[model samples]
Target: MEAKFQIFLILLAVLAGTALLARRINVAPAILLMLAGIALAFVPGMPTVELPPELVLLVVLPPLIYSASVAMSWREFKSNLRPIILLALGCVIFTAFAVAAATHYLIGLPWAVGFLLGAIVAPPDVVAPLAIARKLGMPRRILVVLEGEGLANDATALILYRFTAAAITTGLFSLPKATGTFAVIVVCEIVFGVAVGWLSLRARHHARDPQVEITLSLITPYLAFWIPEHFGGSGVIATVACGLYISWNGPLLISSATRLQGIFFWDLIIFLVEGLLFLLTGFQMRLLFEKSKAFPLEDILIATALVAIIVVVARFAWVYPATYLPRLISKRIRERDPAPNWRTVFVISFTGVRGAVSLAAALALPLALPSGEAFPHRDMILFVAFGVIFITLVGMGSGLPLVARWLDITRDGRDEHRAEHEAEIAARREVLAAALQSLDAITDDRRLSDEVVKLLRARHESRTNQLPDSLDPDAYDVSAAGTALTRELIAAERKFIHVLLRDGKITDETRRRIERDLDLEEASLSNREFRKIAL
Candidate 1:
């Protein structure tokens, strides 16, 4: 128990240190964390740390999927539904088949075993590449599609994995029946997921207390996921459905306090989960290394290379056709959503970085059949899966920023961001105008005092005046400088507040209230500054 606790602490330290270094170097934390884990694994006298398959599949996945689903904009997700489905459902299946064919033909694995390997490595991980792409400011739609695909593709891959594994175990396979079951799972999970979301929201809304509401929010994903997964369905779809339903409906029902507290809570949870997950994924390198001695190094190398190359090539093969063929075939699609830039499509293809899910799925494979025979090529599958993850994450993840820069994708992204900022300013003005109108009505209806009315109007006016009229370079520079000065002023005020507290000029309760106000102001300033930099 002591050793286990020590290892956990070590992992947390590595996670935090690697993330900080990655940010400093402008690299994805996932990439660096994985590398750090691998390095630590091979260090002399470092105790072996095994990642439990159940821990990932049952424990880690639900919250990760739920958090991402909630973060996604339902409007954007719906608008891009067709492309998302193409990548999530169609592309995943296509990639799996492509892998199965390649491995069977090139490496002489049996059909079922090859397909199992395919399913294990099919879904692209959402964490690593998306991190790199967001920092590089890839186009918003591409991010949506990629993120949407990441949210749901695991279900497809896992289902395929189960079916293929069952076929190998029982020697029975039926494509038509499996297809029907797949359709049923998709439909049922969506309905079930939405139901879970609706219930969760109602529970939290009535709970009212921030602590209880946040606790319910944490419980939601597991409820949506575990039941379906227990009954042989991928919990991913259900969890995603639940999250989307909550995202679309929670604002009106949820208390502001809960929302504020929940954001920080979820953000912290996701950061730790993602960072530790990648690190542990890298730790598998040592285990795979020890297992590799049984097989010839040449065979493992050849198979890993073949599958890695096929996964990359296969994405390119499917993405180009899937992206454009619809536009060519249907005028409706073309008119409603014109063909995206070829470069955008190319980036999407290049970002098929396999992640921890693949490793987890491979690790979860059965050790033997019911007949007591060893599971075919189980160790080999683990090796290849890890190799593919390492290759795509390091190779594709590192190269993505360069590709985005070379394609000049960020130019359009910057324009879009500027437009968004402009829209935000306009919306602020409109809302303030509406508030002033409301104030006038309230003043007359309630017969408010002249003092109160004047104070409210001045507050609204002050807020309206804070919005910049333009996002031009000169305006941006002025805004930036003003914000910096404001922060320095706030820091000075904080120092004075501490001095007052030290002199016993204020009670602790009074000091806390003042500090809270200052904190809120600083937080708002930080948010604005982040947006300015993001733009």
Candidate 2:
């Protein structure tokens, strides 16, 4: 028990170091974490960490999916639903079949085994590329489309994976039955996921404690995933649906305190889990190398290189036609949605970097079939899966920022800020108008004093006037300037407090209390400023 606990701490410490290093170097943490894990694998006294397939599927995946789902923009997702569906469902199926065909012909794997490999790598992992994408200042629409595809594609890929693995195990295949089952699983998962989200939201509304509500938020995703999956449905889809449903209704249903706390908690959870998962993927290298020793190293390299190229090319092939074909065929689509430029399409196609889902699916493969023999080409599949992840994640992710710069597709925040400011101004005016009407009604009552009514009306009118008008760009500039100045003042106060602490002018307790107040002010300033410019 002591040794096990020590090993866990060591892994965490390594993860922390790698994360900090990645940030300092401006590389995505996932790439560094994987590299760190690989280096650690050869170190003396390093414990081998093996994650069982069932655990990865059932335990590791649910919360990650939920956190992503809750943070996703429902409005943006719906707006790009058509292309998202094409990439998620259509592209996923197409990639699986394409890769399967390539594997069967080039690598000479059996059709069922080849398809299994396809299914494993089909869904691109959103975590690594998204972190890089945000830093690269990629367009919001492209980010939304990518996120939606990642969220939705896993279900499709995993379903195909299950059917292919089953075919391999049973030595039988049925296309019609498989198609019917896939449809049923998708529909059932969505229905159950929505129910979980709705009930969780309702529960949150009635809860008095913020802590309890946060706890419920943690459990909601797992419940969403487990319930549907228990009945032979895709847990991945269920978790995403639950997250989307709750996120869409969050503003109205959740308290401000609960929302803020939940965001912090989930963000931390995701960071730790995501970093740990990537690092663990690296740790699997020794095992993978051991398993592949029977095959010629040159042959394995050829297979890995071939599959990686195929997956990359397949995404480009699917993205262009899928993106433009709809607008070409449908007048309604053309009118409703303007086609994106070739640059945007190229970015989307190039940035299909695979991550945890692919690794998890590959690791989750059974050690043996039902016939009690070793799973055919399992070693080769695992090797190739990792190859694809490394190539795509490190290779594509590293180049994405450069591509964004070259294409001049980086977001400037002007459009987003303008729209947000307009909405804020409208809301401010509405509430102030309502306040004035209430003051008038109170002034008419016999119990209300003229002095109180006059004071209330003056306050409301002043506030209404202070709000920036939509037509006056100068008002927005002034408001933003004031917020920025306030932030500077807050920073000055923080510096003074630190100096006081450094000089021992105040006790640690006193310094902490003063700093807390300063922190709150800074936080408020940040929130206001973020509304104006933050991504």
Question: Which residue pairs collide, candidate 2?
Answer: none
Which stretches of model 1 miss by more than 4 angstroms? Answer: 530-535
Q: After aligning candidate 2 to the native by TM-score, how far in Å is the CA of 239 from where it should be?
A: 1.1
Q: For candidate 2, lDDT tens digit of each residue in 353-440?
A: 8886787788878889887999999888989998898888889888888887788776543464456567867887888898788777
Clashes of 2: 0
Name the lDDT value of residue 312 in candidate 1. Answer: 95
Give each prediction's root-mean-square deviation over alpha carbons.
1.3, 3.8
TM-score of each: 0.98, 0.88
For all candidates in order, the CA lDDT equals 0.91, 0.84
